[model samples]
Target: MNETIIRPNPSIVYMIFQLKTNQPSSKLIYSIGPNGVFPDTQGMLQQHSDAISTVIDYSQGETSEVSYLKLRRSHGVINMTSWSILMIMGYIIARHFKKWDPIWFYLHASIQTISFVAGTAGILIGYALSKKVDANVNNHKNIAIIILVLGILQVFAIILRPKPESKLRKYWNWYHHYIGRILIIFAIANTIYGLSLAKEGSKWFLAYGISIAILVIITIILEVRMWIVARRKTQSTNNSSHPQSLEFAYQT
Candidate 1:
């Protein structure tokens, strides 16, 4: 019997059953660690995970290095899109498009949700890739985990957002803004760390660097424009009120 199985990444429970039978009792369900052969953190890469379960026993000792290398590269690419592109895009929408009102909120939420989901997937893949490689990734892994936790908090904060006129709204705004800014900082730092570890290529690094530079430039321009617009509106209001002041003086 075929069962449609859907689960989160790195699910802990494991089930074993004969394919030809529809008996639930026959299935043996148990808890499982990363690989069938459980190991400590330092020995994680030594275990034969499903992704790189096979190894050559020949004298040359050529194993699954190629596959794991490709997996590492794929992990890097996923994080690049997730943290670098989607997260930054969400931030831009929320910060720069306030004039869009509620529409900006929706776009920001959607983009951030996607970014969080993608980032989760990237970290999971990174963990799985870790089981297949020997490079030290403790710091990178810790930073990514922190990012995940912060992302969850951000989601909850959105869900529990206070109304504009609420007394607590200002505090909420501060928490949201500062936490988001910190999250972005960590995400960028982790991405740079991953890139350096991957050592993919100079061209890839150049492209990522260029993209970041462009984003910074755009943000600066929009920020200046916001200042200019606010100042012009303030000046216009002052100029319009000067005639009223003169009229009041004449009447007096």
Candidate 2:
């Protein structure tokens, strides 16, 4: 008969066996380091010992802390990307294609719906991973909750949108835009926090930085163009009214 004691760590499993034979109890301990061979003592043991060691190594390797972290990181990345695309890119597209009317609206709505679904799934996965890892990321969790609530509210707002001719349409537009802007800002902040927790490399930051910079630049350009167009339209309208004024003055 043999009593086995297993000690598990982030990267390795240490197994100690105490065998009860005709002689006094003999103790054998073997530590299985990452990508290392089994202890010399393991070779001296019976076939059963070899089988046990193999099982321990395989199990530990599969469920290592590194593997869990990778899984969590993937979830975070997906959530961040989805939210960014929908909130930032989709908003820009909707504004840019406003002249296309119903087409832009449909595109915006579809993107937002997909983003919400992906973000919800990501949050659920993160919660499960946090519990498994016993993580204490209260700020990240709180921000995520806020984002989810705002997203749900946005969806409902769209569903209950008033007709363009209705007086309430103006109020609905204001509420929708303000809430969306807040949600996007908080979502980006939370995503950065999550990246920090994941201990990602500099490349991830660089990628996101570039993306945000491009979005900002494009938005600025579009805004300036819109302003110029509006100004020209106003000038044209004023010039057309000048002829009517001159005719009335001449008759007087």
Task: Say which candidate scores most in TM-score.
Answer: 2
Model 2 residue 145 CA deviation in Å: 0.4
Q: Residues 58-87, candidate 1: write the lDDT tens digits.
A: 456454333566677778878888876778
Model 2, residue 4: what's the lDDT?
Answer: 80
State the TM-score for model 2: 0.74
Clashes of each: 0, 0
- Candidate 2 residues lying further than 4 Å off, grouped into runs, are 1-55, 58-66
Worst 10-residue stretch by lDDT in candidate 1?
A: 23-32
Candidate 2 residue-wise lDDT, 48-139, digit = tens: 12121111233343321223656687787778877774588878877787898888988888888888888889888888887755566788
